[model samples]
Target: MTARWKPNVTVAAVIERQGRYLLVEEQCPDGLRLNNPAGHLDPGESPAAGCARETLEETAHHFVPTALVGIYMARTLQPLEGQSEDVTYLRFAFTGTLGEFDASRTLDDGIVRTLWMTIEEIRASVERHRSPLLLQCVEDHAEGRRHPLELLHVDPSVAGAP
Candidate 1:
């Protein structure tokens, strides 16, 4: 029997302040690329919590997710040096205010730096984005597209339910 398909699940924080959106510049397999502070949902945590953790780890800034921006799915198949397989990603995007920064903390591996960019600037640099979700999440936040955080319900059976 063929194995069941499972797309990667990730959480992202869309933090905007003073007319700019926060983004992380990370070193990808191809090269350095820009993306929202996002990462895979770790075991035993809710998506919102995961977003907050990833944002802090990547940008050194604390993030409190107030609302869900949107859920997105995308498939990719890029040629590698040898071989590669098609991959799909399911992203849960959130928008929230950024809290204090931990200046003494170090960023995660592959994270070169963190910077804020205007929507126009982000739009013009699509080629440098780690994935299309980067622009999509920013645009959605700009358009005032957001759902209540209560939209996501985690049952008690799930580990670390809060």
Candidate 2:
């Protein structure tokens, strides 16, 4: 039987304040890269919840996702020790209110630090981005492309069968 194909599902928070977007610098296999507070979605949680959780974990700030910025798909060839593999990702991007930062909380593993950058700065540092989708998501958010949260329906089954 052929193996079924599945794209890695992830969530990201497009948080902007005072004309700057929040991003994280992290250590990846390639090196340190800049990206929105994003990570793989965990089982049993809705995408918005996952975004909020990832944002808090990576940035030490509470994020309340109020709108869906966009859904994006991208593929990249990841270089392994002796081989390269193509990986596709399905990302749900969200824009929302960023609440208080917890000074007592340490950032997630591999997350070097979080910083705010303008569009110009983000565009100038394309080579340092974790994924191209990082800039696309930010541009979409800046263009005011937002969908209602109700567009994503999470059935009770998402939490698992009773």
Candidate 3:
């Protein structure tokens, strides 16, 4: 029997302050790359909650997701060890308010540091991005493409209720 295919699910926080957007520099298989503060969605948590958690882990800043920016899907060949495999990612992008930074926290593995970049700078660094969605999410947020957070309904069963 063939194995079932499942797209990896992730959540990202598109945080803007003044005229810059928050981004993370992380180590990737190809090299260092920039991306929105994002990570895989954890089990038993809503996408917004996952975004908040990933933002804190990657940027050491508290994030409160206010709106859903957009959902994106992309497929790529990811290198693992000496082999490459096709991978599909389903990402939930969100716009939100950034709160206080925690100086005592350490960033997640592979995450080097967080920085703020203008849209122009981001546009110029497309080749250095982890994925194209990095710029797309920021552009969507800049264009005021937002949907109410109420659009996502997390049923209790997501927490493993019987």
lDDT of 2 by residue, 56-159 (tens): 99999999999999999999988788788899999999999999999999999999999999999999999999987999999999999999999999999989
Error of 3 at 21 (Å): 0.4
Relative to the true structure, how large is the alpha-carbon lDDT of every model?
A: 0.93, 0.96, 0.94
**What is the per-residue lDDT of model 3 for residues 1-162, given as tens digits with 9 covering 90 to 100?**
999999999999999989999999999999999999999999999999999999999999999999999999999888899999898999999998999999999999999999999999999999999987899899999999999999999998998975
Give candidate 1's TM-score. Answer: 0.95
TM-score of each: 0.95, 0.97, 0.97
Which ten-residue region of model 3 has the weakest summed lDDT?
153-162
Question: Which of 1 and 2 is the better model by TM-score?
Answer: 2
Error of 2 at 110 (Å): 0.5
lDDT of 1: 0.93
Off by over 4 Å in 3: none
Q: How accurate is candidate 2 locally (lDDT)?
A: 0.96
